[model samples]
Target: MAKRQPKLVLAPAQGIPFNLLVLSQSNVRRVKNGVTIDDLAVDIERRGLLQGLSVRPLLDAGGQDTGTFHVPAGGRRFRALEILVKRNRLAPDAVIPCVVKPADGDVSAEEDSYAENAFREPLHPLDEFRGMQQLVDQGGKIEDVAARFHVTPAVVRQRLKLACVSPVLHEIYAADGMTLEQLMAFTVSDDHARQEQVWELIQSHHNQSAHFIRARLNESTVPARDPRALFVGIDTYVAGGGCVVRDLFEEDRGGWLQDAALLDRLVLEKLGAEADRIRAEGWKWVEAAIDLPYGYHHGLRPIEATHTPPTEAKLAEVATLQAEAEALENEWSGADEIPDEIDARVNALDERIAELAGGSWNYDPAEMAMAGVFVTIERNGELSVDPGWVRAEDEPVVESEPHGEGEGAQREDGVDGDHRQPGLAPESGEDEVQTEEEDEGIKPLPDRLISELTAERTLALQDAIAGNPQVAFAAVLHNLVLATFYYGRAESCLMVTLTKVGFGFQPSGMKDSPAAVAIEARHAMWKERLPESDRDLWDALQMLDANEQAELFAHCAAYSVNALYEVAPKYDNGRISAHTVERRLVHSHVLARAVGLDMVASGWKPTADNFFGKVTKARIIAAVTEGKGGETAALIDHLKKPDMAREAERLMDGAGWLPEPLRTPELPAQADLLEAPATSELPAFLAEPDVSGDEEPMAIAAE
Candidate 1:
């Protein structure tokens, strides 16, 4: 093996004077790439030639060696040295390092040049980022590093940020396990724990999109474009000790606010100040909130106000705008599509006219004193002041009762049917005094006893109504009408009342509730079938036969039920008393049974995120005990709350269990009401079946 290796002759190396070296036409490199020769020349002049140029003996036609050398490889270096000589920086006779090769060497000058240019690998981006970061960490200024590398300061800073990614992610990036974009996403958060958590969550998933990673990292943050953030300018936010996180790798729309709680506090503080300022305008009350739920003015009356007339100058300006708009419209009338400038002008004129016309409204002083204003923020981050909203209870009370003759009969309690009163005046003499014992031996029942009796009566009435579904259905319809047309009053046979269900504060996942989904679907279905006009509804209902009516009645009756548990009234002004809520729920259970509601059967199941994850460990265990078995609950009791909740959720799956509110109260079985009950017993209107009689079975099943 040793004998087989041929003797290797290395390329010759020697020093050559700058004057003797000459550029070679055989050099392979022609196109510009990487660093330019001019930049190389500056570098060589500053530091002298770093790499030796490749030179060959300049041979004449007779093959005799010439004293001058022809440079091949590193021609750029030769040119750089030549420029220095031309600038008189380098002496013409200055010694230059050169690698000499025989003119007839085995390796051609072109091959040597090509090898030098194409063999070296460029540095990886991650390596460059890390190198930059190291320089920054070692005390090099970002500006200094950028100047040294011929890059923008922003680019240097971005590279430094990428270097600040979670070390675990950096390792992955270095190993080519993650993309550069994903690594950039991790730079959004400096917290290594959160970065690793988000990475761990999405790493195995196919959807490791950079945007998804950024979104997950910034889930709890407020986008810079959010109305709240816009209202509180970024400068003010930062001045108030808030931070913003930016994505240097992609467009982030000015980035995201890192401190959501601080932003909220600032928003509330500003809104409160604005509210106070508005309150100083002599309004009775000013309700301020970031957002008011849709239909917030329910059960309140909005008084119409007279608009203030515009000033003469403003009127003239409006007239001018109108004239301009008219001219533009006339000029572009025949065009299929209006020009953007003309359209913009028309829109601007319309807005100006509206602003001029929508002057401040004037309300009567008396009405303003009793009315309140809603100080709110609009979607566009502008302040909105809605005035002249009067609650029903706030309206002045009018005397409606007739006066009686005697002093005692005059209702000295200050109002008729009023129970709360001051202690009866102490009589002056024994003859006039009527003590408790001196009065008849009768006393009113205790309030608690009255409540209990009414509770029982409510239960009995619900049971009775359940037996007669026809009356129950009609009562529900009557209640709905009373609620719609006569707010705060009822003339229905049923005492139940359904408050307007406001979209007030929503729980996190309420929109995903199966009950909400079913309700929405049903609403859409009925909306499509209902007549367009209110006047057409009576005829439409008449067209539906008995079976359809019964089905429709059952559906409509569902809305009137008030089974929700509410806070008891601390003050007696509210309609529902503490005991009333309790009794109402108890009666609701009976109604629920009559309707045969089974929430579990209605496509609801316990899940860790939606239900179990939110509750306490004890609640989760209790749910597992109820839905699964006590054994299952015991198995998970030793686990942490989150883990126990998840396990309990899994164990409770497919088990027909429900919370008290959603469960249909179990009732004793009876013969099928549809088959046994006589048709005559049903409502006169519902006695006859539909033409197809298809929905009759549905009505029975619904009951």
Candidate 2:
């Protein structure tokens, strides 16, 4: 410990003439890498050599200094200076600052070169970003900084913007707690507090991806493409004191809209203005909402308004479009996949022709007096004005003076007051005074009320006939015979119409449903086979085989099936007698039974997303009990609701079970053919959640 240590000696600093400097062959840098000599030369020309070269004097056979120097470490730098001199940018005798090593030292030129290459560390990307930011902050122009770094201005700016991220995140990135990409995602939102909060939430999650981080930050914000945001233009929203969050790191699809509540208010206000304009048109009521609930049209009557006839110019335009569409279709007659350009052109032509052929319709004063309009935004961000909707209470009522009896009424025996034959009246043998039974007939339903009932009946019939091909053919033949033989005197339950109902409120997932795909394919095939002209449709149908005709009729009738449970109720004021919705559902069940429909076989299953996540623990247990017996269900009964649902989904796979709504009522004959299962007791299922809502929920297991 007491021994003295020798003092460290350093290389002497001196200036050597550029002409006397030469690259050392003993340098350890065998592989050429990093910046090119020309680029370094340009850098040197702009600003003289920043770092001095390491040089050792060459020795003769006697081991004496030869006055000429050789670069052992900074060979690249020496070569760059040589390029500058060759280009005449520097004088041949220019002095180059160098750290001159002793000629007689034990350190070889290769050792010096190895130390120069091995002992240096490359600058981290974050450090570079920060250094560039610091330079810009110190009054340096971005262009000057980019030039110094030999990078594009755009690249420089992107890196410098990284400094805008939270300091904590920067430290995290430096410490390798998060990746550079994730750190970049954090910069999309400038809120340090939000970034920290998101990190705290996702730090323990297995999915700590950059995408997840961005999504968490935008939880309450609306994307630029969101229909509500699109309906309210971003510029208008900004003018109304809304802020837009932009992403500098990537293409952000026009960025997200902050202040979602403010955006919604603006949307509602615009919808209200549109509603006011419609109100001026004398609508009974005009309702404005950002979004209307599903089945908003329930208990209301849809009426078709008189459309303005197409003008000669519009007709000519439609004809031209039709011609173009026909030519395109003929050219691509049997191609499996038409080219996108041709397909798009054909679609555009078809749309334009349809638009030109049809006239825009609006409600007249009389219809508006009895109907209302719903002004809202369509999914495409367009203002949608749904007019000519007559609510039940708004339908007109017929009045009659006090009379002996109603002119039109139905009796308990199903005889109509106006339809009773004179021969059925009381004869001379019977008392002339009217009895209770004689006056039991009630007033018949109004014409509009009868039409609503008939509409529901027609829908039920369509579903019934579609599922039964024999019935479908028979129904069509019956209608034809009635029209041909009995003229207008006959009435049938089945009524086919050219009108097709649109399910605007269909679930988003239904777009890709198996049923939907099949229906769409069949519709396309028929559309392709049919003639362009309506007059030619009859001839085309006659030309089809019997099976083809039956299939086409079923396809058409299938479009009329409306099994959706709508919200409709009757009022006590006689405004509406009944909704007839339950009757429609009963018919749907019957049709389902006839077709032997199996929702499970149709690729629908009770999963955590569509079923379990929305239900209670007890419901999940009950489902498991039904599908996999009480014994198996008991295994997951002790777990928490979430765990229980997951377990139940696993246990119930391929069990052919269905939720209540999706279940088709069992057929009588099918039920008779099944054997009853024996019941056995298992562990008790969990009780339902308490109604008080104060009890600790999800505590079945200790976290």
Top TM-score hit: 2
- lDDT string for model 1 (1-703, tens) is 5678789877767787888888888998887777777777777776677778888999989999888989889887887777887888889999888888889988898898889878868889888999999999899999988877778999998999998888888888889998888888888888899999878776444457898788778867899998788877899899999999999988999999999999999999988998899777777888988776554666786666877888888888888988998898898899899878878879989998989966667887788888899976766678878888888878889888664442223355463221223354433553343343346565444334466799899899999989997657656654554454335454454666766655544554454467766765775576577664444555565566678766666555565556666554445444655556656666876876776877777777777766788888888888888887887778777766765665667678788777655665444357564456453232221233455745333222110
TM-score to native of every candidate shown: 0.59, 0.61
lDDT of 1: 0.74
For model 2, how does the per-residue alpha-carbon lDDT over 485-535 read when each residue is reduced to its tens digit?
222223554553333445655544554568867877886687678754444
lDDT of each: 0.74, 0.75
How many collisions per candidate?
Answer: 0, 0
In candidate 2, which residue ranges exceed 4 Å CA deviation? 45-48, 60-64, 86-92, 139-144, 152-154, 157-162, 238-255, 278-284, 305-365, 397-703
* The best candidate in terms of lDDT: 2
Model 2 clashes, total count: 0
Off by over 4 Å in 1: 1-50, 76-97, 104-111, 131-154, 166-172, 175-178, 196-216, 293-295, 309-313, 320-352, 378-385, 401-482, 489-703
User: How many Å off is the CA of 647 in candidate 1?
Assistant: 15
